[model samples]
Target: MSRGAGTAVGVLLILTGLVWAGQGLGLIGGSFMTGQTRWLVIGLAVASVGAALLAFVRRRGG
Candidate 1:
């Protein structure tokens, strides 16, 4: 993907992960994932991947 597209996807992933994490932690409610440990773990993993993608893009001068 293009640098711009990658950046956008990374940011979106980070935001989505944060929301999922919040839901998992019961900080943002009304979802089936609320208070779910599995969701929390998944969210953290996704956020980490997003962060890694952002870092890689930046490092590559993209």
Candidate 2:
């Protein structure tokens, strides 16, 4: 994907992951994910991937 597209997707992934993590951790309750450690771990992994994508794009100078 183009740099701009990649960046946008990466940011979106990060935001979504944060929300999921919050929900999973009961920090932002009101859903089935609340207090779910599994979701929290999954969200963290997704966020890390997003971060890695951003870093890769930047490193590639694209």
Query: How much does each candidate deviate from the true structure in C-alpha RMSD?
Result: 0.8, 0.7
TM-scores of the candidates are 0.93, 0.93
Residue-by-residue lDDT tens digits, candidate 1, 1-62: 77888898889888889988888888989989999978888888888889988888888875
Tens-digit per-residue lDDT, 1-62, candidate 2: 88998898889889989988998899998899999998899889889889998998788877
Clash total of candidate 1: 0
Count backbone clashes in candidate 2: 0
lDDT for model 2 comes to: 0.89
| Stretches of model 2 off by over 4 angstroms after superposition | none
* lDDT measured at residue 36 in model 1 versus the true structure, 0 to 100: 96
lDDT of each: 0.87, 0.89
Residue 18 lDDT, candidate 1, scale 0-100: 90
Q: What's model 2's lDDT at 61? A: 74
